[model samples]
Target chain A: MSDTSANRRQRVQSAETGMSVLKALARLGGDASLTAIAAEVDENAAKVHRYLLSLVQEGMVAQNAATQHYHLGPESVRIGLAALRQCDPVRMGEMALVRLRESLQVTCFIAVMGNRGPTVLRIEEPSLPVTVNMRAGSVLPWLWSASGQAFLAFSDDADIRVQAQAEFDAGNEAQRSMLAGPDPVARLCRQVKEQGCAIVIDTLLRGISAVAAPIFDARGRVVAVLTALGASNGFDARPGGKVCPQVMREAATISHAMGFGPG
Target chain B: MSDTSANRRQRVQSAETGMSVLKALARLGGDASLTAIAAEVDENAAKVHRYLLSLVQEGMVAQNAATQHYHLGPESVRIGLAALRQCDPVRMGEMALVRLRESLQVTCFIAVMGNRGPTVLRIEEPSLPVTVNMRAGSVLPWLWSASGQAFLAFSDDADIRVQAQAEFDAGNEAQRSMLAGPDPVARLCRQVKEQGCAIVIDTLLRGISAVAAPIFDARGRVVAVLTALGASNGFDARPGGKVCPQVMREAATISHAMGFGPG
Candidate 1:
């Protein structure tokens, strides 16, 4: 390679290392001493400090005057919020639902926790559409529908609590009996957590089966739910079934796209 | 310098250039082609593309497969969320309030738009307390208080509209005349926006005057309002007065800390 090419390649390598340092700072939970960041990125403290000075100058990282600990700066937050605004759940979910419908040959949909409840945002039906009552704007039942169950299973929000209680109080005897126990909600939630998804068969609607999984944001909050439903006669809503895992995988993909993952 | 030292310095320079490329992308609204980013940072497209590849590898930027336009990636969102989580408005407001109280020798406070109204979250008093009826948890009226008006002026939210209208309807005849016009709310909002801060003199309380300004988040949403108040005799609540500018400066400082600014 020419000397100029070599210099350019060296510069790119250095830039990548600097980005790794920034990523390490974020991975360290957004606040850490220079020493800690250097250790995290496996670089010497002096070298890390130099990179940090550049980051600070660019307003991507800030050093606290009191503690000298580096944290993400306004530029980082601005960039993130921009990314957040761009990564629309409906758009991403629509793309994922189409892929799921094509691959699994089932009717798939995405639902977001709207002010009212789990409101369906997007739906993709296979060549043979599943004749369920739900449409794009259908608000699924809190304790009955698979999508709502998945959200309830993962959330601890006070608003969700009120909505769930109201739904339970308004349910008829048969609906209440389906979740029969001293603490049926807790039991159902525990089961869903254990299975990594929520499954329901002929519960929310007659002859309808569904499997759903929660999509989490970077903050580990459930932002949306992905669900696949079909006729109970043909759909397998079992915990360890093929559909359950597929739904979970798609949900995980969306969550990953939203910057949620294991630390 | 030794060859090794020269190489290290060159690497650092390259890293800074790469970061500039990333920042330029963010400045361009978080999505752009390599050519656009290169132009934004005033670098050659080839050099910008190389830096983008490094950023893409680090997951701080991603190129859309269909369009090949680069945007902030998941890691950028993750880091920004960390920054957002870290930049607590209450804590930052508390610090700013203390400074305002110390510098101006006036009672200063910060309020967030809570469910009820503009709810005071933090308050700092000068050596002599203002002796107001309000406390930390006091909920200021939407149309009456400077803090509330600052928020109402900046926000186009339906919730704020409902709350402001309710406050207007519940006001007594004398209180209603305080904002007298065909569309008093619109007039007040327009004045506040024009002033870039809200000011009130003996409007909410008999002997009190206050100046408040909105603290915005990364998305330019008013997340909090910073207010300073004193006895009507001592306080200067005019738009171009010393107190109004101080309050606006402090609020802008906090907003910058929260990642809000002009592009």
Candidate 2:
């Protein structure tokens, strides 16, 4: 049987451009003049003004009457909060990392399997911060980084495998070895699932080793991966070391908070 | 000099309606058909479809290809995360509440004064689980609840007072005394400001008591209130009790996290 719905997956280009105007405003510190926003989006000021009018009307953007500048509105914040409440492993995992940061004076981060790849959602650093360039919105390769590998190892969803496979196929020869040859990705994922954690040292970032643990949801699905990044000199990420157990325990705490059972 | 900008306080009615369609979807559990969204927002299906197209373009909403159902898109989540990162006292307060919940074995909640009232943003519950009716998005009254009182007590912002005055004026004769007569709201606010906490017992719900402390922003403005709710029999809300010290300590920690210094 054929589907009859007329909904199109192909997004309208003008609408995308209009939305880009809002992103430009957000990127420009959430407030900017029409000319600035237009310049940022590389569109005409008149066209950007019309889009801003629609955005202001929709309560997604706000305009200051005196300055004639635009920023995010109250309704936008409310909508964002609603979205965060829905499936936010970011907020749920941040607290656990804070505790882990207290135990070990290292930087901790959380990554989630997003639409494109495993994206960093939050980062926690101790008082003496490490030299890390990553922040929220940084997408990591699924088979390369420890956070990405933790996601790959714990996730059993078909949709996820499709995306990871795409990332694997479009990779360099070294990257191809991760999902093929002697040490396949499937076997690694099985090991990660069995051990409840994953580790990588000096793989992605230079002199930076990261160990990540998978956070499961109520259905035991890997929703997020919590990772700790520290210098290779002092950090230990072996299977039976102090790092893995603490990370695993914190992951379990977050998983329980997310409604997973006592397992 | 007279201001030349023609921006009006009145929102664009159509844009409000368009935004309402998204709220309708969120209220309907974040996914619904066009017909359902139209019915909820009191608009026609065809007009709603046009708005949905714009939303889809903006990446604020997504339409499932097979079922033709609409839900939050990735961009909406990203925008929300960015907003949260900008001024998220909710996330900053939740971690302290988690630590408090660990020590007390009681449930804690964070509420921010929203456009309507102090709305619950996050809830931290222990494993045993207390009998609680409130959840995230539940709005608490400014005059009747502990969370509202905590907000009213510590906030010196003139805009906040206007809203609180409106809430006070809307109440019955008994509530007017809380603002006008012998035991004025100003006096109570002063007391709360001195003590740094507010308590409400058997006010809204029977056999349940709640204590709240205000969390301040960088400028020493009350941004959110951290509240602990427990059964009346086991909980204490007095100034010298165990609960008050822990709640206030946690509140102070959260305030520091939100950029408030020890003043």
Candidate 3:
């Protein structure tokens, strides 16, 4: 190969090794002795120590003055917050919708807690799309919609409570009966939290069934909700049904992209 | 020299270059084209492209499939969040106290919004200590203490408002008179917010004055308050004074270390 082609094919092995050491620090819970990091990365202590020195110089790893244990430094925190600032939930959730549509063959959408209520932010439809009335920017009811239920269950924001109270007061007799309790809003929320996802069978719309799951941020706050629905006659909305796991899994994947889980 | 000694002395230049590229991408607001990143790092496009490929493989960088722009990837987010999890405000504030004690020759302490109120978590005393009765775990009053006022000015937590109201209702005649007006709590909060830092001249303790500033987290919430105090007779606690700027500067530095600034 020519020099240019050969250079193009060459990978920077030292950089890759450095990144491995950094990842090992993260996997060790962001704090460890030099020996522990060396053992975790399966490298010799002296070599790992050299890389740690370089990392400390770069401000990616810091050493404790008292104990000499190494931990991630301020630059890592700055870069992570920068990455988080770029983590667009709507864009990531849209990718999830496309995947869910293909896997479950059902219409899927992502909703965020907007000023009014849970508003649909993005949507994806199967080849044969379900004829739902909702579209992007459609405000889902706080009590009657699966997306809203997920928010009520997972989020503790005061605005959700206000909206829920308003819906409870204005709910029709049949709707109130469906909620079925002295404190129906609380009861519904408790049920959804216990179930770990929200399910609706012909509740929000006639002949439609849906499943919804919450998406969380690094701080463990619900940032959005992912929902999937189809005709009730063919769609299974139970927690154990096929659509439920797919929706929850997709929601979790988006949450991971949003930096939600363990480091 | 022995081969082993020679190897030990060698620094990984490629790894350092890779880290520089990553930092450059972050400086470019976490998203940019290959040409932009190369120019920012002052490196040749070919060399930067090779580093980008390695970074992409290591999951530290991602390219937009449509636009072909590079951005920080999931691994960077994960590592950043990991670093954030390791960010302990009390531990960092303690170090800040040590520095302030040396340079400013004042007693410094860090307080967090605990269940009761602004509770002192860590304290550092200078060589010539101020004769303060409070120690770590001393919860200061909401309306009287500079630390408490920092939270009042910046935080929107509902609990703080309730605590302020309770303090307002229970204030003694003299204390209530000091906080004069139809809505003294609101007025105090507004004044503190406008000032950008809370100042107390012999308000909390006779002959003791303090300047307190808020320390923010990545989410821009006030995580802790740092205060420096000395005898009011000799101490200059006004905004334009030497003590006020030093306290605010230290708090801002700690906030930056806590990932509270621009990417």
Error in Å for residue A204 of model 1: 6.8
Candidate 3 overall Cα lDDT vs. reference? 0.85
Query: Which order, best to worst by TM-score?
Result: 3, 1, 2
lDDT of model 3 at position B38:
100
Off by over 4 Å in 3: A1-10, A102-105, A141-214, A231-249, B1-11, B103-105, B115-117, B141-214, B219-222, B231-249
List, residue by residue over B110-134, the lDDT tens digit for candidate 3.
Answer: 9998988899999999888989998
What lDDT, from 0 to 1, does candidate 2 have?
0.74
Tens-digit lDDT track of model 1 for B1-263: 12365445534677778878887888887888888999999988877888887887777887766578898878888888888888878765666887899988999889998888899988888888879988899999998899999999999898887788888999999778888789888899999999999988888999999999999988788999999999999877777887989889989988987898853
Per-model tally of clashing residue pairs? 0, 0, 0
Shift in Å, residue A20, candidate 3: 3.2
Global lDDT of each candidate: 0.84, 0.74, 0.85
Q: Tell me the lDDT of model 2 at B158.
A: 72
Better of 2 and 3 by lDDT: 3
* TM-score for each model: 0.72, 0.38, 0.76
Candidate 1: Cα lDDT at B91 = 62
Residues A1-263, candidate 3: write the lDDT tens digits: 12355654766878878888988899898999999999999999988887887677677887777689998887888788778888877876767888888988999999998988899989889899879998999999888889999999899988788788898789888777788868878889899998889998888898999899999986699989999999999898888888988888889988876767763
Of the pair 2 and 3, which is ahead by TM-score?
A: 3
The superposed Cα distance between candidate 1 and the true structure at residue B34, in angstroms, equals: 3.9
lDDT of 2 by residue, A109-215 (tens): 88887788889988889999779888989999876688888988787777766666777778778656545556466676887778878887777777888889988
Q: Please give the lDDT score at residue A125 for candidate 3.
A: 91
> In candidate 1, residue A20 scores what lDDT?
91
Report the CAPRI category for model 1. Answer: acceptable
